[model samples]
Target: MKQNLLGAIYLSLAASMWGGMYVISKYVLDFVPPLTLVWLRYIIAFVVLFAILKWLERKNENRAPIQKRDWFLLVWIGFIGYFASIALQFIGTKLSDAHTGSLITSATPAFIVFFARFLLKEKLTLRKICSVTLATIGVMTVIGWNINVGTYFWGSIILVGAAVTWALLSVYVKIASERFSSLTITTYAVLFALIFTTPFMLWELQSKDITYESSYVILGVLYLGIVSTAAAFFLWNKGLELMDAGIGSLFFFFQPLVGSFLGWLLLHEKLTFHFFIGGALILAGVLIVTLPTKSVENE
Candidate 1:
């Protein structure tokens, strides 16, 4: 019970960081191109995570290094996760509202549940199904039923792409965790992501000039890099290792909650009835997924 509680806290913290990240990324995107910003974020995160890994290794000489076979998995995860998904998120959010990005990516837990079945061979129980269904309904309610495909069509599509890739990353991370430590996986995966993103960052720089509105933009970038990418990623992976992937993924709904709250607070967006209603449903869904019933425990 204590471990599960700790896992919930870690996942919640990670989700909150990512939720608040949209606002920071939106501001920073004014100065930095999407691919360039992603590259820079990974670069900063990689350096910090690598330094920590090195320090830890020095302290504990007995820890085993990652095997040769796992390199491919790490690289693949880096490519799909940080390089593709996060870049899509930046581009999507730049083109759409932060609330839209949060709502759309809120569907990630559903995809995680789906992928978990095949990838992790996790049983698809009725409670898990209902949890995902309820959360998805809540997301739709929060975002509204009206479709404006003519205006932000591509942005919505891109955000969906981001959600799918991120879900894939989560499931794969669980698979990888069976063999590798979370810190090792996160550091190396981010290093590979940085390597993959460099060329794209350079290409983006060819036509785009980065200009900061204020020194505060630097702070935003630092927060995105160190806190969001480095620390939050570690926390998220650690949380996943401590709990079932589906249960762990239920914490993702916290992203939309935090994102919506921050969006209202910082951007002065209105808090409507839908927000409260949807938020409640989302919370209920999370409780359903995380609070293991007698049947779930037996499974």
Candidate 2:
């Protein structure tokens, strides 16, 4: 019970941080191009994560070496989750509108549910199905029906690919958790992602110049690297380690809700009636999955 609560807290915090990440990324992207910014974020996050991992290793002094298979899994996580999904997301959002990107990628948790069932062999409970449906509806409500589907068909497909890749990342993280600590998994996975993103960053630099003159841009980069990448990734992995991937995935709904709230707060965006209604449904869906029931307890 305590672990479930902790898992929920971790997942919620991670999702909320990612929600704010959009706002920070919006500001930072003006100075840094998409691929370059992703590369920088990974570099900073990897350094921080590596330092902490080393400190923990020293404190423990008896950690086992990671196996070859584990290394492959870690690399897969980095390539698919950090590099590919993020790149696809940026490209898709560039091609489509933000509304289409948000609406489509919001299906990530649903994909996670499917992946969890297939990879982890978790049962597809009625509760999970209903929760995902409710939360998905809430997300559509929050994002609205402002999609330019005919114009952005290819972008939408890429965003779907992004969602699938992210879901695979989540499930793979859970699988890896059986062998390594979440910290170790996150650190090593991010290290590999930094490696994968290097060429893209260099390629992007050939065409674009980064503006480093503004303090706001510097701070935004730092925040994205530290808070959103390092801290949030660790939190998310740790959360998934503690709970069933499907149940933990419902907390992802918090991302859109918090993003909407932050947009209203920081950018002075208007809050519509749909935001509150959708936000409530999202919260309710999370609660339905997270809160213990008699049947779940028996299982």
Candidate 3:
């Protein structure tokens, strides 16, 4: 009840589920187009989560009124958090290497910790600072620190933008939940994402013929929309509302590790020394952030 191990374990598992999502998403591209896959994800999420929450209301433990100010923030969360980030991520992944996309996206936690301090009025600690530093270094290493790879440049930039947007959304959710239910926030976020992406959906339909042209297409859409978008994000915001942003974001570490493994096993990508060493640092950083220190327990 004090946001202890149970809470941490639950949130960590949720994050791990998300970490595994990239592999599923990367696998599903042959069955669905990126934009269409995004659309279906949010649309399905909107319906499923709304209905699930409604049914959950009977538990008499979950329900609330969200104030107008909170509503405004959540709307943006849905738009930016759900729609924009999701769209940009797939777009970036589409154009970039899986390794680059993953490394850049890991910045979500770093953003959360940064924004928590600067925008949400949270205190920073030395251990967290070091974790952030190490994670950043690890991510940069995976990015190759060499800009000459024209193939990965623009895509990496977009992925970085996606990471930033997601971090901002996490901060907004943390602040917004003070006056709103995390359930309401999650539900509304998906609904608003659906609304925001509708224009793109129309344009997509008008111009492109979205076919389940490849098995990759199908897997990408289903996994991203249903599991990653709906379950992962909903749980993420929930965990963030209940705990520190840094702790919540440490869950993101799984994404790159899972992605890298799957890429080598499935995508036939080479597993370089850089990938393993960088991944180890990122994973270690996540554990460092999530584990309770003496200061936390004594407090």
Q: Which one is best on lDDT?
A: 2
What TM-scores do the predictions have?
Answer: 0.92, 0.98, 0.83
Per-residue CA lDDT of model 2 for 21-62, tens digit only, reads: 998998888889989999889999999999999998999978
Arrange candidates, best lDDT first: 2, 1, 3
Candidate scoring better on TM-score of 1 and 3: 1
- Candidate 3 residue 120 C-alpha distance from true site, Å: 1.6
Clashes of 1: 0
**What CA RMSD would candidate 3 show?**
3.4
Off by over 4 Å in 2: 297-299
Q: Looking at model 2, report the run of 10 residues with the lowest lDDT sum.
A: 290-299
Better of 1 and 3 by lDDT: 1
For model 1 the local lDDT of residue 165 reads: 98
Q: 168-254, model 3: which lDDT tens digit per residue?
A: 898888887787667778888888888888888888778666666666665566666667767877777778878877656666665
Worst 10 residues of 3 by lDDT: 140-149
lDDT tens digits, residues 144-236, model 1?
766444578789899999999999988888888888889988999999999988998899899998888899888988999999999999989
Which residue pairs does candidate 1 place in steric collision? none
Cand. 2 TM to true fold: 0.98
| The best candidate in terms of TM-score | 2
